[model samples]
Target: MLRIKGTIGDWPVDLSVEMDDADWARLAQNLPTVAVAPSAQVAAQPAAAGPADKLWLAAQDLLRRSGSVEGPELMDELEALAGSTGAAKGLLVRLRHSPKVKIEVRDGVQVFNWVEE
Candidate 1:
């Protein structure tokens, strides 16, 4: 016997199913088999760029689009984009020292500007 109870949208749902041994046996017999290759048998592959690489690219794009943006605001956007505050802060620090980005002060706020070559 299988029972499922849940809510879909604003409506409640209840479902129950009962199967005998023969039904279970038939179902199992019709199921497909999956074959998996052993790790030793698989070919070696080149390493791929990780999430940090992707975040760096995204940070570059965001700066390019905005020309200049406040440091804290940029950090917030990067945090949302990276889904991690630590990652965002790390990227911001990297950007601050990057030759392609220029850090300046406007009024009392630090601003990041994309340096175009």
Candidate 2:
């Protein structure tokens, strides 16, 4: 038996326990659609955390200041807040009703901006 794992590209992932001969053939036979349920997949995704939820709520405060935000000016702030607080970008955008996020440069300072609905 062999264990296989590690990166295929920039993506970080893990694969384990390589099989041979008969075992490989058995797995190959089920490749089309093997023992998977849609509900199981939906359930497997973990629920979002509450603190992260709150942080995003706070980010929305910035959105209220303006319909959008400057990306470059706020990327560090946004990424830091989101990463440290475990907030999801999708959630942030959805909650704030601002999907158009962007960056710009002025007077050598990069600025971040977003459009709100």
What TM-score does candidate 2 reach? 0.31
Q: How far in Å is the alpha carbon of 112 misplaced in model 2?
A: 6.4
1-117, model 1: which lDDT tens digit per residue? 545689999999998777665654454343332222213212232236333444455667778889999999999987776666766765676677567898889999999999988
lDDT of 2 by residue, 1-117 (tens): 434468879987676664555663353233222222224323444565233334444455554455445544354455554553223333333432334545457677644455454
- Candidate with the greatest lDDT versus the true structure: 1
TM-scores for the candidates: 0.57, 0.31
* Model 2 segments more than 4 A misplaced: 1-49, 66-68, 83-117
What is candidate 2's CA lDDT for residue 16?
Answer: 62
